[model samples]
Target: MKAAPPKATFAICGVTLLSFALLSATDRFADAAVLGGFIPARLSGLAVPYALPVWLTPLSATLLHGGLLHLGFNLLMLYFCGRDDEVALGRPGVVLLYVLGAYGAAAAHYAVGPHSTSPMVGASGAISALVGAYAILYGQRRPSKFSPEVARWLHIARLAAAWIAVQLMLGLVSRTQGLAIAWAAHVGGFLVGLIIARPLLRWRYRKA
Candidate 1:
């Protein structure tokens, strides 16, 4: 039986939506994005005007989205995957996973696009981490005839492959439209989710 969705999941969604509404209402959407979004170049000391301080952008970026479509897709993913994760990992664990995932996303963007000034906005990276945690926890539900360790690794490999393929395809599509997709950040966040889910699950069980 499925557990009730955790309150933190809804609260995070509410915060994201409320912040988006307020930011959009108070300034040009582009202006807010520029001011709050993660721009790797800012950390690299580029001259991008209106960019937030380098230290602030990673967390701030999670609260900004390019459009309704962007926000909607992320919130949808976050609700479903995040609910499952929260059920398994608890509220504090989910929030920690999300914050670390955002940092992971920013690290990946810095590794790949250190000099690029494009502001990376949206909750997709953090949501991708939640999806990864969900994949690890729920994807290996049935006991396999193979060794449990082998089965778990195999499941993760399949999920990772599918995720990488989809992100690559999205990257191509974004490029065609003259936009950057930050596939690296997605991969980074997903990797963090996969890595931490098991430990977080154990910690939750221990606490119980």
Candidate 2:
């Protein structure tokens, strides 16, 4: 029998599509982002924005993207990694990992850029979590398609360093252009995924 589709993957994609459509179809993009995007100051009670509640922003913000490239990149990563996770870890487990990653990302962004007023939005942070999970799941082999096998930890470390360096460069460029990029959030999400992936995998598979 054809198995049922992965719920987490479909749900995430649906929400992202709906968000992009609604936000782009009207003039409410900025307003929606402001209302839904994570603002650490608001969440931490250091400041409050009247437009939206602080607690929900972290999750809501995951549904947002800065542009088509941003959305496409996140969706591609989510499709590849999220489906694999759902198959390996079960629907609930994958969803929980994603949510936890989002929260972790928010926490890190809050820590590093607490005073900034710009709202942080996008699924890269959560997607980075999936990348981390992927690393843990398949780290025994060489990560890059073009490379030979290496030590698992070394592969993960190299990938993490490269990810951080690229994100930092992009963040710097964006900031210089009056844009904000929550690259720190990406690091946090990746860490969360890396830390939890093995335990989650063992727990899920051991029972199956």
Candidate 3:
């Protein structure tokens, strides 16, 4: 059957296309690390004092994955989180949330990380934000009545909380080893989603 028109989001296909394009560029074009960002590239393009400077790298970096497993895992999560969200928020809202989350990730890195002119890259922050957005917006849902038949998978809050713990733990591990991990970014982005999710959902409801 032909798909019914998307209920909330606009240009849903476009967002998916762009995301795939980023994957191709980083995976195919540069042949660099795919899932994560690089120190050198993160530093280039756009600067402002004490602000989360938007850069082109975050755009592509969010799609690039480090390895097959890395990309695959994130893609699975994104499929669950992003597809629904894009459908809910439409293109503009999707873009806004993604950018905000990405920037939040970068800002956290800059704030806590020791002054290394390293380029930061990765979609974990943004994707994590998407994860966060899903958690917060879904906010304490019982499994739908059909849950036993189909949706009986997971609780939204539980998944989001678990993910947060994992990110924080990973960051601590990185810190202990003196390795460069942008754990702070994940925290920041996740928090951004948490803080604003209810409002966004309310707005969407009102808009509808």
lDDT of every model, 2 decimals: 0.82, 0.80, 0.58
Tell me the lDDT of candidate 1. Answer: 0.82
RMSD of each: 2.8, 3.5, 7.4
Per-residue lDDT over 120-171 for candidate 3, one digit per residue giving the tens place of the 0 to 100 score:
5556677777777777655445647654424423455466668767655554
Q: Tens digit of lDDT per residue, candidate 2, span 1-208?
A: 6655788888888899898988888857777777888877675565545656777788889987767666776788788888878877778888888999998999899889888778898887887788788877777653454444457777788777876676566566556535577888999999988999888889887856
The residue pairs that clash in candidate 3, if any, are 9-90, 10-90, 34-64, 34-65, 35-64, 35-65, 35-66, 37-121, 38-119, 39-119
On residues 65-103, what C-alpha lDDT tens digit does candidate 1 reach at each position?
756666676788889888889988999999999998898
Clashing pairs in 1: none
Model 2's lDDT to the true fold?
A: 0.80
Candidate 1 — which residues are off by over 4 angstroms? 1-5, 23-27, 47-50, 142-147, 164-178
Better of 1 and 2 by TM-score: 2
The clash numbers for all candidates, in the given order, read 0, 0, 10
Off by over 4 Å in 2: 1-4, 44-50, 142-150, 165-178
